[model samples]
Target: MKTALCIGGTRFVGRHTVEELLAHDYDVTTFTRGIHDDPFADRAGVSHIPGDRTDRDALESAAAEVAPSVVIDFCAYHPREVKTATEVFVDARYVYVSSGSAYARPDVPMRENGTPIHDCTPEQATDDSAESYGPRKAEGDRAVAVAAVEGVEAMAVRPMLVYGPHDYTERFAYWVGRVAEYDRVLVPGDGGSLLHRSYVEDVARALRIVAEEGEPGEAYNVADRNAFSLSESLELVADALDTEVDVVGASERELAAVGLEPADFPLYTPRPMLVSTEKLASLGWESTPKADAVAATATAHVENGRDGAENGPARKDEEKVLEAMEETSA
Candidate 1:
């Protein structure tokens, strides 16, 4: 059986990737700092190596132990980390998880080669703030390219706004929670906001496919085939919950009247964020159906008791905004 090593497999996409690898009949080993619980501690054909990824020696030790055929990296935030990992796993197939944020332009459909990559300054590469995240990821993609030039089997997969079960980011869960708990859900900007999303399972599958069949030095974008508007997404959640909700759309003026901005709402993008998955589709990748994916996510959200209270404005704040909108309409 082929052996696969994951750099950050204890949570979110990493966790799903491990399960995906196992389903494909690969022996999986996850290298994490051992702070979080390991869901695969007892799973068959899986192992764990506890160490900090930033530590070169730790990574080298794991490399020597597993000799993985493919290495999927999920936690390399800094460009230097990606550079170091490419060197350490020089002999293995390396796939770095990049983000759509790496695209410098706000093109309607960001293409892998068509869009310019955000340039990363030395300062930005090391900075951990949200502002620098795209630059750092763009630089990491450059690192993968460099490794490929040196004959390493390195590739990058860029996913946009991944959501599903065990999503620690809780961005999508915030919406799911609102649909599940409230009768009148507040949606920003006429509820026509579009933010492309990739289901966690599909992303995990993309990682494996890119490692096995993708060309070195190329980056592939991963997202659901059909992008959903913010209002449609809420409707999907409501369907998943076997209930109905009145999706209340609040205009920018309405939101501002309550001392709120559209940005305050989670996943509220003033401009539509989209990326083309055609390249990945060329490699034989297919996304999960939107309705089915939302169902699974809703089920998991309830099971995990993830209210997503921290992701967006509090319920009281939302109520205030809703009340203000009602008064103006009256």
Candidate 2:
């Protein structure tokens, strides 16, 4: 059996990727801070090492003790985090879960070679702002890409706006919940913009496949092959719930007046975040059906009691915006 060490394997993508690994019969060890409870702690084939990735000594000690054949990281945000990890696990094949935001100002379907990447050192930012987050992540991926070690392979798997069950972000769930709660919905910008999102389980599977079959020094974008427009996305969510809601298009200024920023809402981008998955498909990886993923998310919203129509504190603001939008259009 192949020995796998998963850094930060107790959370959303980490947990799901571990499950996928276990299903493949890989001998797995999970590394976490012992803060969040691990749902799979009792699974017979799994083991755990308690430590913080930010703590170089703690992570180095774990890496030496585990001596895994493969290392998949889930919580490497800073380049320092991945740089230390690469140094410690120099002999292991590495797979880092990077984000699509690493692409610099992508306006079309972002291919592995498609866009100008955010080639920045994290130290340049000095602060973790919205602008810095992508560059920081890009630096982390670059850390693995430029490793000087011989006979070692590392690849970056970039996923765009991952969503599914246990999504604490509540961005996508907010939309599903909105459809369940109200008859009319305030959609921004006529719903013509494209949003690329990957289901958690699908991304998890892609990580496993890439780890097994991906080429070293390569990066793959793990996302749905087809890009869904905002309108198509909302329709899929509503169809999964078997309901129809009126969609009112609102301008950003109008939404801002009611305290709803487009950035605050889920999948609210004006630019197309399309990604070409040709590299991933070339590896013979298959993702779950988009409809199945959508249905599962819609079902999760209802079953998890997260299907509230309003965005908690922003509920009144949303309603006010809707009422004012109606008044203006009438």
Candidate 3:
């Protein structure tokens, strides 16, 4: 059986990637800090190596032990981390998880080759602020290129906002919960805001495919085959919940009346953010249908009792905005 080593596979995408590898008949071993619960602790074909990825000695030890044919890295946030992993796993096919944020500009359909990557300053590379996230990911992509040039089979997979089961981010769950509990939902902007997102399983599969079939030194974008508007997404959640909801579109002034900005809402962007998935699709990959993905997410949200209260404006604040709108309409 093909041996695969996953760096950081105990949570979120990492968790799903391990399952994907197992489904494909690979002997999987995950390397993590052991802080989070291990979902694969008793799985038949899965194992774990407790270590800090930032420590080169720990990574080297894992590399020496597994000698993995493929290494999917989910925890490499900085460029330095990518550089070290590429050097240590130089012989294996290494796939680095990058982000759509790495693209400098918000193009309508951010193509892998057409878009310019965000430049990382020396300060940005070391900083851990939210503002520096994209630049840091971009620099990590560059590091992969450097390794590929040295004959390392290194590639990058840039996934846009990922949502699905086991999503700790809970950004999407906020909408799922609102749709489930409320009769009317408050949507920011004109409700046509487009934010491309990928299903977690699709992203996990992309990591495996890119590691196995992608061209060295190239970056591939992964997102839902179809991008949805904010209003449409809420509608999808409602459909998944088997109910109907009044999606109330809120203007900037209306939201500000309740002391909330459009930015305050999770997944609300003034400009449309999209990425082209043709590059990844060309490798014989396909994305889950948006409806099916949403259904799965909604089901998981209910099962986990994730209200996503911290992800967006509180329900009480939303009610204030709704009351103001009602008075204006009346």
lDDT of 1 by residue, 1-330 (tens): 999999999899999999999999999999999999999999999999999999999999999999999999999999999999999999899999999999999898999999999999999988989999999999999999999999999999999999999998888889989998999999887999999999999999999999999999999999999999989999999999999999998777877776778898888898989999999999999999999999999889988988687888778878988888778779
lDDT scores of the candidates, listed in order: 0.94, 0.81, 0.94
User: How far in Å is the alpha carbon of 18 misplaced in model 3?
Assistant: 0.7
Candidate 3 clashing pairs? none
| Residue 148's lDDT in candidate 3 | 94
> Per-residue CA lDDT of candidate 3, range 251-308, in tens?
9999888799999888888898999999999999999998999999998998899878
Off by over 4 Å in 2: 148-150, 253-261, 307-313, 328-330
lDDT for residue 47 in candidate 3, whole number 0-100: 89
- Model 1 CA RMSD to the hidden true structure, in angstroms: 1.0
Q: Pick the candidate with the highest TM-score.
A: 3
lDDT comparison, 1 vs 2, better candidate? 1
Residue pairs of candidate 2 with colliding backbone atoms: 109-274
| lDDT score at residue 24, model 1, on the 0-100 scale | 96
lDDT of 2 at 301: 71
